[model samples]
Target: MSDTSERNQAVQIPQEAFDWYDAYAHGGMDRRTFMRKLGTLVAVGYSMSVLTSALLPNYALAEQVSFNDEDIIARYEVFDSPAGYGKGKGYLVKPATGAGRYPAVLVIHENRGLNPYVKDVARRLAKAGFLAFAPDALFPVGGYPGNDDEGRALQRELDKSKVQNDFVAAAKHLKSHALGNGKLGAVGFCFGGYMVNYLAAVDSDLLAAGVPFYGTPAPKALRNNIKAPLLVQLGELDERVNKTWPEYEQDLQANHVEYHMFMYQGAHHGFHNDSTSRFDKASAELAWQRTLAFFTKKLA
Candidate 1:
């Protein structure tokens, strides 16, 4: 079958992606080059103009986020985790009003680590009256390397057990932080989204709500352990992630897990990250609104 025909199953990763990835991994190519090349690989057979246009905006991680630094108490903090792997670092942002405790939301970044866009996302969450923390999954490897390829490479070296612990610890800390009212929620995109799913499943008692954007859901084995409500946003064009949702949703329903899912029409993976041209603005905004409403309701 052609690669397109196997979309219902696992789509094969392109050799071009592997080539660029390898080059980037070995420091032979910069992040921009790798991403551009990877984009071409993703839309194999597409015209060069279309391919370049689709991926450039995404690599530009600093899109215009409305919230200014003054709007929030943005800072870098070293947090203690329950997992005890070691102290980890992350970006913490909250409303500048700084008057009293508020609901807390843990922001997990895409595979690229806690880049400017993800930090901007934390600011957005703060504007919505939640304390947001965007943890660098690569923190233990000396934090986000200021290079996407390097950051991704560092991220691959993490111990899976430690990775989960870091998030769990961050959630545990955020929920009980001096700025928290004991309610905690999480939002993650791409890789981070899947982590949010993992967080929801294992640390259900700590997480009140979770929003996973284009992320994989926790496996069925962990379904019964989920106590928090979930808001799953899916892009219609992302087959790999979409293929797993049906079964996961069935498990959620069977386990009586409180969950809601929305499929954005004619969207692709990473649609919520406006830094990418693949982003569907209308759908992204709608998804964000629903995320806020759901978190407010569930975490309240």
Candidate 2:
């Protein structure tokens, strides 16, 4: 079958799925005015997804692709870095079907560590035509924290210098991979976002694009060294870091860098992680669309 036929066969959503959506809409907004406004928002979101999926070949292909843990082509491995983080490890997810050279993406995990969510992001990139490498930034620190409470405890013990070394090692490993296209990009969430910015600032030649979601901004002096196109997504109501994003954005503009900045009106810090209670579906979906487009334009 043709790719389009395959996609059409794979992308169908059952009619029953819409029933929950209908009930949620009816239950969430009692006022006609509120319901109308929400309905319009939902319509716009739906239209964007449909149009985007139809227009982008990668997006269409992504819809038809599925991955399971057992399907991983490259196994996880540990590496020694000169930056003193001994035995830093990373997971590599390669395309299951392709035989040719593929673009590479470096995925950095949030403070919570390299969990299933980070793995899913790697798999998504692979499906979209890139080989994804997600390094376990916490391996040197004796593994990532288990939960918010435990994560905080582990965070206090982490060595910043070691983490930087781990990132550098991860980037180098991805760049040297057999399947890697040698054109690399980086994407990070929360703490990983900060690392992405730092990597872009220090190792511009290693990355063609950088996407940081609710990440800490690089120092003003380092901004001049950023050689990659940057796409930053900020959450306006994020309790932790929203207050400083505007000033940071100004710094990017002052440096005359190519950048795209977006602020989701009421999203929280972890909005992109579906497992989080703070996950804002609308904002997350839009941010993801922007991310894929940005990577396609800059790295592809």
Candidate 3:
């Protein structure tokens, strides 16, 4: 490839552009507005196509572990959630060679539902010897639709309370599953991260541990109720989320909840998601190692 072509391929998206994408992805900004704002980057020599491609997630490039990997078993299964979504469905993966029960983890997705990236995360957890289940909050609305823009819209239509119930039900379901060893943990990113905090707060007995990556904090009233250990991950450049961290830390400490927080310098929100240009390799790897260690210690 020509040096110019290679340069274009390795183009570094400006942090401001990432802020725009993050707002759009989280519903604060509409697609038309986001794209129009991004178009301004063309004046600075960025092609619109390249800029768009860099911001949007390309799930094809995000898989770290495959669904059919020989070391793990992965499949879709339905679980009862009568009080929440009537019937919930999710991707479940577990170690293929393990005869004994494994510690369970509930993998929650972002607001866009149980997309491929989140399913891949479940597979990664299973590859590490944990029984992982990723429930689709969009199932009641017809599932993920294979497109994140559409998935986000579908998720917005659901009642937030019902969605929370669905995840709470998922935690209970995974904790009690036959293949689980009666210990349960959760890991979530962005919206999923908030769910992890919420889960830790709501069901102290059901969730033994949690990892929330750049998620919004649970309400202050609920923070004191959290008993499960938490490994909170954040990006230094994400002001929207980080602004709430101080009070959250105070709450956790005041309540004596066991926890540790990591702030990745120069990283932005969604740094752990490899499907986008915002992914910070060094931070993501270190966070994953810490996450695995935390789960291993607490789940055991």
Candidate 4:
């Protein structure tokens, strides 16, 4: 009856009990087997207090659970914006295993407007542990339906001033949200990429990182004002915007801006949008990995 022997006796569990409980918790065994093992542990003089602690629901347990359940779901829900701006509303895509105080990202949709691709991107960002918000940049004006033939039409309809205001408002809203970590970054595609660049110019104070995927080049005058670290993705074969990318790189270099410029070989515009056969899965995945890494380093 030595103290050490008594302590060891009290804490010991039969190997069968440990294996059964661990396997059941991890889904390798059934509940009946788990309870049978538990009964055995109690009979063997293990305290019920210990078993309760082991079996009780725990937040830490949720952390270890895989988000592989195919039936589990999450989606974007739009909340309010300031009065007077008809389309200042912001949408959030919450992860199924929701996090508190997660870092935030603002996703700016292309000139064709907010579509399923934009929402999917937001959800992917949320899955990566960011509080992702994709505000409708075209909402203040007439909403633009994405169409190949009408792409130019949609481009002509955007009101830059209002979009800028909406972006600023969205940034402020995300920074103050209850779930926000206050560290913010932005990602944009096509014309939205240009907006992301513009945001870096006007709202650098709030942004920790920026990624602009094939966005039009910003006016040279605004380059020096871009204070956040940026990652610019371009398609070398994109005839519409490829001509100006070199100058943009030069501007980034001259201003001593922290940036990464990636030119995808043989890729074209809209290469990152999965809905299109034009999507370059390899290049898009690489760019996405780079974007996520950049945000992790800068925003986390």
Candidate 5:
């Protein structure tokens, strides 16, 4: 690579993520597959190293939870997806010491399944006093299998409508859980963020609040169907997602939808994901804090 070429490459978000964002946003690919493609395209160099790091398991996902199991009652459970798509599996997390019903949060993961980072997000919610559950969107495909490429391939094969129904089912399950206080809220990142936007755009009685980080808007037609309050977070540097915001905002207002948005000046897509270089700790922390406040005010 020439000096100018190397400088340009270094200045951009990893070359690996160029197509990943659009693919994942459209529900066409997964993060693992993105990294794998990155590795293959750039045989040997710094690019290859980036690919390796991106695919590595983020075992140390959350700084707050520290993988501590005792703080919350965590387990795997099956939820029904009525679209004839079969059962859905997820990691259910709640305050271990809490007694009595608590507000429930549907924690949706990125395009990938319920990996460690997402599971830890659930734990973080648990710590904040919400009964959180992170569902594996790839459950029908034999689960995540700890491989991104495989996960993306499976994610692409999903029936979009049925998959959405599965997410709704997860919310319903949490709402009806004995540990739940009946109210429900949702939070999602990346692909999951789009899911959050989807839920908000749909007329679901099960959802009371939604927070989508760096996600696109719901389809233009569904804007009026939103009955729940939404706190949409955005990364200023994420052109793909941000580019649609203006039009989305107009539609939301025209429909009188209840929604709010926050954009971090220097943050890029996936800024809230702690596992990757894309993470912006300051912005992520602020977004999370705002989410907690939103859920507490709306769900509690």
Candidate 6:
């Protein structure tokens, strides 16, 4: 079947199934329970295998820009994060043929650490003419474990504060890197989204721009600390994350933070991610276009 056919089939999945999957993805539900609950969808004519295949991420489809793309160079790099995790590692990508320093972007992954989707995002950023790095928070525990469930479990075992510090350190490292123009921007999804908000909150000097996709907002007190321009992308149906936005907007307005928020009409949480059924192509494309434009206006 064509990819479009598969996506249409995935769209036939019930909303309840997506909710169950989202709950499970975020750790609110265990795998056994998730699988069992998801199995209930079998009554609707979806075999368990088809349900799993349609709901889970297919990394093979995640790449919009190839690692070997002529426009960018990609590789692994390690950096020190003394205050956070001791040693941090990540995938770094940058313009292959550019001579001058480029504005750098730190790509923060979801709760599952530095997975392929996030790496692909780094490559996309590089192709757009920026130095991009995606640090693996699970590196201290042996890296992504080759699967998201295990990866999420590994991330949960780490000291949350240390992980946050690691990202903060990453932003600093890339901003000061020899190949960078000294301006730093960040983009993150899910847990990474929260981290982007956290980064902008704690460090005003490093991040010049930030795009947080449907992640939770920083605490009200910390929200006042943000000084970077923010382009917040949210899904209209993601109530779990959306409930936190009103006060967040008030805080941003009260503090005079430069930010714009767009709530995609029919998109759900994880809408920007194309590897799963939750991906909303139109919304994701529009959001990304806006994101790149915002970066150009602010970072370039």
Q: How far in Å is the alpha carbon of 83 misplaced in model 1?
A: 2.8
* Overall lDDT per candidate, in order of appearance: 0.76, 0.69, 0.89, 0.68, 0.78, 0.89
Q: Which tens-of-lDDT digit does each residue in 112-216 have in candidate 6?
A: 989999999999999999899999999898899888888988998899999999998888889898998989999999999999999999977769999999989
Whole-model alpha-carbon lDDT for candidate 5: 0.78
Summarize candidate 4's per-residue lDDT along 1-300 as a digit string, tens digits.
443343234234444544454344334676677787688778867765555343322222222212343322344444444532534755575555655677889998766566667766777787787788888755555544544224334545556666666777787788777887888899998777887888788755878899999887666787788888999999766655677787888888888889989999966666687553345679989999999999889888
Measure candidate 5: CA RMSD: 4.8
RMSD per model, one decimal: 7.0, 11.3, 2.0, 20.0, 4.8, 1.3
Q: Write the per-residue lDDT of candidate 3 for residues 39-155, one digit (tens) a residue.
A: 788887877766766678879879999878999998888988877978899999999987758999999999998988999999999999999999999999889999899999999
Where model 6 places Cα greater than 4 Å from the true spot, the runs are 1-4
Q: Candidate 4 regions off by >4 Å?
A: 1-87, 141-155
For model 3 the TM-score comes to 0.96
- TM-score for each candidate, following the candidate numbering: 0.82, 0.73, 0.96, 0.69, 0.84, 0.97
The TM-score of predicted model 4 comes to 0.69
lDDT agreement of model 2 with the native: 0.69
lDDT of 5 by residue, 1-300 (tens): 443343235435454454464565456676577657665657645565444344333445445585566777788999888773779999988898868598999998877677778888999999888999899988888898785556666787888888888987787788899999998899998889888888877755768999988877778788778778889999887888898899988887887778899999887787787665556689999999899999999987
Name the candidate, 2 or 6, with the larger lDDT value: 6
Candidate with more favorable, higher lDDT: 4 or 5 = 5
* Model 2 regions more than 4 Å off: 1-74, 145-148
